[model samples]
Target: MECKFLLDDFHVFAVDTIGHPGKSAEVCLSPNNYDYGIWVSDIITALGYDKMLCFGGSFGGGILSKTMCVSPEKIEKAVLLVPAGIKNAPAYKLLNMLFPMIMYWITKKETWLLKCILPMAISEKNIASDTYETAKCSIDHVKIKAGMPSDVNPEDMKNYKASTLVMAAEKDCLFPADLVLPQAKKIIADCTVYLITERGHMHYLTEAEKRMIVDFLHDN
Candidate 1:
């Protein structure tokens, strides 16, 4: 999704995440200044948003959800879409360590790797020609956070108190519904988990999915 879209719709303030393009981890790592969570906390205090709603797609979802664990007092609600924070899982932990190595080895032709991996990791029905481009665009945008950090501990996830909504695609190979469904139940025992039929790992928020999220927010 585009940043301008949110700016037009909500009182949106976008802070580029680390590891993506345009955002530098060095700056974001400063607790006194720009650490992702700290920066968000600073914004909340400065803007007088004592309780903010958190929403993220893909990796953004992972970071936003973790922020709820680390700084739960600042969040009122959370929405995660194909979020990537299940560090406790072996496959994910392996991906975190291997991704950099794989990237280095693949060189400029890295885009090819995404084409293969996205479909294999996610469900077959969700793969599309545009999916690789979209994934590459996001990688080119969000900065990488230090700590080579990946994966959210299951315990921290279980402790989160914010009203939560998680949507996963039934066909998503990258972050499958099987993993996500169980994680959602553990993270927020009472929250609703909806599976998007015939969708994949792509980040295009569909009208129905958007409506579901809006409804969840309205109810909670």
Candidate 2:
């Protein structure tokens, strides 16, 4: 979504994660092993970039972390946004979010489901009619797998060589900022962490936040 902001200043490659609803082949690498790292590295090599900045959010963050662990040399810098793999969603939060969506899936109650989940998933300031419609369409059509990515091993993370910027959403149910910050600081050799306030799992970045990210990438 921030591609517009970066387009003039950087060459952005927005890869559709495999198995998500996109043109990419539906071949998911196992998150429990190094397969994800290998898969992403192959893509980068294919794309002909010797090294580049990598930005990932949510599920993409898990894949990026795996890449960082196994092939840090390929990344110039890394930016992770409320990423998975730092920790799994707390069980109660998972159940609360999933139960209604599952019921909607079985019963085909689209309106009811959106109402139930939107407040939990998005901050009030971030809500927009167009974005809401898009998200609804994606959920309705996408064939998604139903599990949080496996957690990253702190031991593996010690091998990471790239400078990293991590932005964690304070209200993020999937990966709480409080939990992710400490673990990231412990593992990543050169890391900067920011806790974004009044944001949920799905966030809207203000101009200041956008500028912060651009500055980070440029500085690194």
Query: C-alpha displacement of 153 in model 2, angstroms?
Result: 0.5
Query: What lDDT score belongs to each candidate, Candidate 1 first?
Result: 0.59, 0.79
Each prediction's TM-score versus the true structure: 0.68, 0.90
* C-alpha lDDT of residue 185 in model 2: 87
How accurate locally is residue 123 in candidate 2, as Cα lDDT from 0 to 100? Answer: 47
Please give the lDDT score at residue 44 for candidate 2: 91
Error of 1 at 217 (Å): 2.1
Give the per-residue lDDT digits (tens) of candidate 2, residues 1-220.
3336777678888887776666888777676787887788988999998878999888788888888888888999999888888876666776666766778778878766775566456744565666667667777888756665678888888778789988888888788898988888888999999998977877678888888888999993
Q: After superposition, how far is residue 15 of candidate 2 from its true place, in Å?
A: 0.7
List residue ranges in candidate 2 displaced over 4 A: 1-3, 119-125, 128-131
Candidate 2 displacement at residue 200 in angstroms: 0.6
